[model samples]
Target: MRKLFSYVLSLCLLVGLFAFNGGTAEAATGLTIKDLAGRTVTFDRTPKRVVVLSPGDLHTLQALGVQVVGRPTSATPVDASLQSVPQVGNIHQPNFEKIVSLQPDVVIAGTSFLGHIQKAQSLGLKVVITSGSSVNDIKSSITLLGKLFNKAQKAKVLVGKIDSKVKKYSKTKTKVRAVILFGSGASSLVALPTSFSGDVLAKAGGENIAASFSQLKDYPGYANLSTERIIASNPDVIFIITHANHAETKKAMIKLMSTSSWRNLKAVKNKNVIFLPSELFAASPGVKITNALDHMNKELLKVRAKMKK
Candidate 1:
């Protein structure tokens, strides 16, 4: 009886020690997370060699201080830290040979790169696709990236900064009527209410005038706006984003504003016509959305002050 009691008490003491040590156990293999596609992606641990495929994903990685082994050639190295990172290929196309050589734990990509994802998966590579269309989608992407890298706290900080900017812009007592015109010469495409820029404008206390009209034929999220409508609606401000690259865009902006028909409008007359940067308006601003919103709000507020004058 004494011998049996000793053995049982030893077992009980071991059980108590284990319980005191925090009963949680890590899986020997890996962990699973949901990407933007809602697909379950597994990771052995936080990826050591990450390949980011888009600017938005780059922003996420930069925010978390995660190591990136590869990136698309087009992605502008935003800081000195990313200047030395190697390029794999363009977002739409990736050099599989180069990626395989790197032996990356996972490849981060934009939702637009489904083909890239398939190709990478075929080569036994892990990929996490992020959705980044609107402000909310960008925030979700940041959160997902944070989860993948175990940098949940950094993700919270990023989301908090974006939310703070949103709250600051959303507090306008009155909405300023605004229109975002794109294209050049006769190609006057306006961003619709459903579009990302349009959404940003609305959030920044500017009412998108183009929301009232149906998208131009097959253009979907965009409609060809005419100078006639500008005269009729008489918006408080006009923000233009041209499709052309480089100096041509600024020239087109000048040309658009120089048209005799647009000169008489109140927005044009009051110097409220703004030509936004292509980085913010044309391509994905990624983590730069916070700065973009701040710039846009400043421009809009300038217009408002001018209107008061």
Candidate 2:
């Protein structure tokens, strides 16, 4: 009888232990998701230490209130809030040593780093490769990041605000023919509508001049156009992005346009030259893009004012 009782007690204890282990496994918080490249990445828990390899990813992480443990050197001084984040190295040639030192649980990269995904994995680092070509891509990236950080609610709110802002601008039917020029001279000219900048312009009520050009490539955001082609396009509003100070770049661009056949274009003749901060217009979806839209809107309103005269 005593032996039978002991055996029953042992069986009950084993069952209880198994149930407890199962519950612990189920309670573990980290979830796994597939990235754009169809690679499965697991998050043991909300990534506390994250390394952002792309500027767009950096901006998204910053917006999510996640501390970026590492970033590339090309990252500019962001808002005062993110000034303290440390740089790991250039994204093109990431400093693996530095990255390991940071001990980031998740490394955020872009399509540009698809080849290096294995290197990250070999180092026991989980990676997420994001693709940001259009505004939709940016929205999707925000959603993925939200899930990774367990901040789905915050991501939804941020994306909603972005959508609302975009909707507010989209309601206007004012389609101004605009050209996005980076740098000076004819060779430096790049036609938009094939780039992320084009998406932003289109969303903000500007009709990109290169959208109809059959020869333009689909991506990289610009078409090499000759002065003749630019003059032929004859855009109504000329928006130039420059690294130089706003006032100086504006003067230089106006001078450059006067020297070219652009003087004959409607935009030049009407004096519709507007200069925007180059960095703000460069890349990614963030407050900079929103601010750029506001600037563009104000400039477009002036153009409207002139047209009414």
Candidate 3:
């Protein structure tokens, strides 16, 4: 009887040990993210100090409630909560010394700055690069950051919001023919279906007239369509996206559209020419992509309503 009792006690302890080990192993599972660039990075533990180098990425982290130690500089103000956060630098020109001083556990950079990735890695900083040039890219960035920061549920909610917005607008077809131009005057480049802004416009019910045109060799998402081609398309709505001098660009655009050939276009005759904000349309709006889509959809709906009259 004594021998049996001892054996039973030993068996119970072994089972308890196994249970504890299992729990630990389960808890030790780390997060691994594959960014838009097809590069993978793993996080064994939640990052406490992160530095985001792009406004789009910064916006995503803000939505996920992941605070950053450093943020990028933008012409417009960032989140009010992050106003006091140190500005390391922007995507084009990052201040590496300042970034290193921040001692971030990870640095989230954009794919536009490939050199930054190598420099950061050389400095022994864990880095992951992402892209937001497309709507899907925006969603992927949110999802990637969510997993990295242990905010997967929040990420899911944000992505669901975008999906819901897309679904809401998809049911109603506006039948609006539109053109999205990077600039208005001689430097204009038309956005293609492959571009992010083009995808947003398409999702919002506007048929991108430039979709069929050949994309630029260097930039597959945009094309340098001639004035004749644009006129032939005869888009019902013309949206201009300019990087600087909004007033000047608008003036030049108006002048260009007022020309004999341009004036004959349907959009010009109907006064449907519009200018989109660069901050919102030129770059990936991240969590605000839904807002961008809503704006476009509402505009298209207005156009449709007027057509009925």
Candidate 4:
């Protein structure tokens, strides 16, 4: 009777061990997700080696506490921990050879590089595409990446922070007419409601003057609004997002504002022109969006207060 009991107990232990291992194996190989390009990607396991082809993706991964093997080349400062990571190239022109040599398990890209996606895929690199064009898109990217990296809790926290800020600022009773310009002066493109910065302005209770302009053919989210139309709108605030050096851009903008044609504009006359920080508003901003929202909201509030006075 003792020998028979021992045999049964050993058999049960073996079965339990097998069951546990099986479940783990299934989980290791069962991940499947869809990219912004409408393609389904399957992973054998959680990615251990990742290469980010855009600055925004790099920022997203960093926020999730995921270390990357390679990052896109940029003039902007990166986290201190990632300073040593290999640069695979910029957003529009990635260094394919270096990326292939890195042998990354996956590469995260943005929607602007659709043409390069297939090229990277052909080289046997799995590319996941994301967009950072709108506030919703930023939140969605954070959520999606959290799932991919198994950091759902952290993503939730970050997204919740953004939601709280939006809710708080969206309640502003003052409605200010505003215009977001990419670059400066006549060469600048006006942001439409469909753009990221424009979306933020709208969310903060500011009316986008360029919303009614016809979208540009090449860039649907921006338009070439004439100086005459801009003056006609007489926006309460003019938010300038610079692509070049901030001081230089501001100087050029000041020069333009002093011109007889633009000097009489309401925003110029009232000193309501604000040059947004390039780090927050120039790019997608990734996890730093909360700071951007706060800055814009505070500036708008000051404008409101001045209006009342």
RMSD of each: 4.8, 5.7, 4.3, 3.3
Using lDDT as the measure, name the better of candidate 1 and candidate 4. Answer: 4
Off by over 4 Å in 2: 1-29, 214-219, 243-255
Query: What's the lDDT for residue 160 in model 2?
Result: 85
Q: Residues 1-309, candidate 1, lDDT per residue (tens digit)? A: 999999999999877765653332213345689998888998765678998777667866887788798877763335787777788875677888988998999888877777667677889999888876678888898899887776878899999999999998889734678888877755678888776688778777778877777776655568877678767888888888776465687677678777888778788888878888766866456777887787778888888788776
| Each prediction's number of clashing residue pairs | 0, 1, 0, 0
Model number with the top TM-score: 4
TM per candidate comes to 0.82, 0.79, 0.87, 0.89
Runs off by more than 4 Å, candidate 3: 1-30
What lDDT tens digits, residue by residue, belong to model 2 across residues 55-157? 7788778788788878766635666756666777655688888888899888888776777877878998788877666677777788888877767788898
In candidate 2, how many Å is residue 8 off?
Answer: 24
List the pairs of residues colliding in candidate 1: none
Kindly indicate the candidate among 3 and 4 with the higher TM-score.
Answer: 4
Query: lDDT per residue, candidate 4, 1-309, as tens digits?
Result: 999999999999877865764434435456789877688988887788999987777878888998999999878887798899999996689999999999998888888778887788889999888888888888988888887777889999989988998898788745888888888667888999998888888777788888789898888689995788898898888899888576787787888889998778878888898888887877677887888888888888888888887
- Stronger candidate by TM-score (2 vs 3): 3
Q: By lDDT, is 1 or 3 better?
A: 3
- Model 1, position 186, has a per-residue lDDT of 56
The local distance difference test score of each candidate is: 0.77, 0.72, 0.84, 0.84
